[model samples]
Target: MRALLEAAGVPMAVARSGLWRPIHPAHVLGIERALRQWGQSMAALGAVAAVRYPERAAVIDENGTTSYGELDRRVERIAAGLHADHKIVAGSKVAILCRNHRGFLEATLAASRVGAEVLFVNTEFAPPQLAAVLERHAPDLLVHDAEFAVPAGIPAVPSDLAALVASDASAAPKPESPGHITILTSGTTGTPKGAPRVPTAMGLAGLMASALGRCGLRSGDPMVIAPPLFHGLGLLTSMMAFFLGSPLVLARKFDAEAVLDQVEEHRVGVIVAVPVMLRRLLEVGPRDLPSLRVVLSGASALGASLASEFIERFGPVLCDAYGSSEVGIATIASSADLIAAPGTVGRPCLGSSVRILDDDGRPVPVGETGRIFVSSGLVFGGYSDGSSKAVVDRRMSTGDMGHLDQAGRLFIDGREDDMIVSGGENVYPVEVEECLARHPAVAEAAVVGVPDEDFGQRLVGYVVLRSPATPDELIAHVRGELARYKTPREIVVVDEFPRNATGKVLRTKFGS
Candidate 1:
């Protein structure tokens, strides 16, 4: 399949052509060796950070902060406890079910120390859903976060079982061991896939380094993480802070007031938020948060008008980035680009290649709508079923539809899965929804492709109006802004649309 994909004729999107500098052969080998060496155990990476910056705070949980030295000690002790108490060792996958607490970090590090991969189960996953994930992954050890205690034989991380591992004095695993992370993808469509987290983490750090350069992140940057620790964005952000020897202040869940308080209290320099969160923050945040140097918004299409509003309110420090779980970091719109382009997801980041491809997997013209494909520096180690071809594909149609402008900036059309084909025309719901939300009366809107006999699939707009906007008025208003064919066929004015815990619209549950 990969060979077939490689043999296909594809022209590079003008935006992607000549955008990246090839890594030196020697440097590539050196980095590969380093990644391999660190793969034996994630603890080696933690050890390097601990030794390099022992006094630096590693994590700032609700209780207090733990320095890198303390974090290392905890990992060593907990890892020993894991092995001695639970008899878990190399090749064991440990399921960690916890909220944004310190135990998550310590348990992950402990599992890594013993060459065990950590399976991060979303705390929000209901009992059956959680059970399904556990059964699928088949973790040898289960670390619940104290609150959830129903699953028999699943030991809590800080329980007596873990205390036993802490009692042991065994050394951490050597480098060159088997891969040590099995993270479940967000799984918006089907079941979540277990993706290797190591490659994802490395790729994210590399991308962050390339885009922000050395000046952005520092030793004590209190990363204000608002996204739940379960999601890829949250988990990877926390891991990057840990890997870089910086302190993370997790919000457990996003709350505008709480986030603002933390930013001021911790003097947080950086924050990673989605586009929606940024809007919410700006709506409720204090007039000034002087310590915040960078505010990163990603995981969804960023709107130009929204970006301008944010900059006008919060000052020019917003960085718009684009990437996914399968392929790590792809493109970044720097602070300058956020001001200049406003809504662009930015040019492809260093060590990555991107192209806009049409339905036939051929690159579209400079300013044409097509599926976005990314060849990234850090691709997943393939799916859990052990298929590396997709991970190594020179170009992967990201299943996202978008177009590139003549200036090489990418504008998202919408997810191919979410695109509504109405009367033989592709109608991107995001574009229409964004247009609807801009109205004076509408506060929030979600556009979904619904089953329709005539059009194959019709666009349905679910809106949360701040004031009052009838369905007819909204439908007419959208028609004026968008192409008549692209306008939503139906507008449903409701208090709210069903959203996941992360606030992403759950279009699948429209009828139900």
Candidate 2:
């Protein structure tokens, strides 16, 4: 508890400037009034942080820096505009469809302030997908970037948020409740569903405690969030930044060299990214990054070769977070954990539990693969459609197959549905994918099963190479690493794999 509080700058100086001073009486009163009106939403966090660190930079985006005081005022003004102009009152649903920038934060915080349920729409969604999601969710207002077109029947305002914040409007007062924040599932296997979770103080603290302690994040450290704010990993880390009074550096797109530039420019202490972003950073080759202390990876699998290579090049600053949209962050792997056991997702977080259960819900033996179940306090009640995951003894299934090491570290084998039976052998594509990734010529690999006449299924490997290599030579590399049946029957070279917004490969695009 103490560590978590300290990391949040409870008694420490504000981030970047390290300014420590007593909270003025007026500031304290303002904070209390704001919280009384807005409750525990992001608006409250911004207001309270403003009272404590009024002059500190709360956000640094393309529009430039916004102090805590300015951020609080902007959020409140935007909320007032939505309330008065758009008639978005308590219980109204507001869908946000912007990339990582000040607009995304402004819209989200504003909607929450007015007690409106905020649905974060993925920016990478195709036009049809976006239209379908908006239609199904039926949000009252659609807050989107300028690049996106507003669907019919939904009231919307583009990313020119500055105008809205400055527009003539009545001040919005307190509401009956703090509205829920809904994050749509990644929808890798199916259509995305709304997963709404009302933020609770205890749930937020538990996640922060585990991440801060395991990843070496601390007070007054600047952070750059490279992933989209819609993902759980990005959302949670952004929340961590607000509470810690850290200056959040954001960009609408993830560019490897540009991210490194921001780290050096802002003296960033932590970077939150997905594994594919990490791979791009490695490809760019970091130089003179003295202020970069932690690189947090999540939202996708971090292959063993990638983890080891990142750690080797970056000198043990990589931490892998594990969880999903259904269940919030359940585990955090520290640098040491990654060093000792590459690809391990660390251990269960504080106030969280992990269980390896068989089909009938019996506990599996240590080091044995089985279904992965996690119980994080932040798990949503149910999807927006009223469908929920199967919960066995309070732990919800993560839909993954994994094993735990003797040291209690968890390693994901693959998605339970992704397992393939080839020649009467159960094979995990991730194992072969990892082996292929280790080859000097291979940059990354994705393996999928195809129906075969002889074997039940056959493995087909698609690889993006760092250097030129023939299929025969790559097949030999995998043969040297694993059994013959485990190797992919055919290797296909690709320029790049189609990726979802959060950087996971869209295997369905590969004709799987």
Candidate 2, residues 251-309: lDDT per residue as tens digits? 99889899999998999999998776777788886588899889998877776777888
Query: Which lDDT tens digits does candidate 1 get at residues 1-512?
Result: 11111222211221122112344576456445534645524565666567656788777767788888888788778877777677777777788777776777777777776777778776655455566677777778777766665455454454223464448567555534644576665343335577674643435444645444422554457888776665566766776676555788874556777888888988988888776677678778455689887787766555777778877787777887777666765777876776766557888765578888766667779978878888865666576866443222377656577888777877776776765545323456676778788889999888887655334456888888899778989988876655565577788887678879998788888767
Off by over 4 Å in 2: 1-31, 186-189, 418-512
Cα deviation of 209, candidate 2, in Å: 1.1
Model 2 reaches what TM-score against the true structure? 0.79
- Report the Cα lDDT for candidate 2: 0.81
Residue 401 miss distance in model 2 (angstroms)? 1.3
**TM-score per model over all chains:** 0.72, 0.79
Off by over 4 Å in 1: 1-41, 152-166, 172-178, 186-189, 200-205, 386-393, 419-512
Residue pairs of candidate 1 with colliding backbone atoms: 40-177, 77-166, 80-165, 81-164, 81-165, 81-166, 82-165
Highest lDDT among the candidates is held by which one? 2
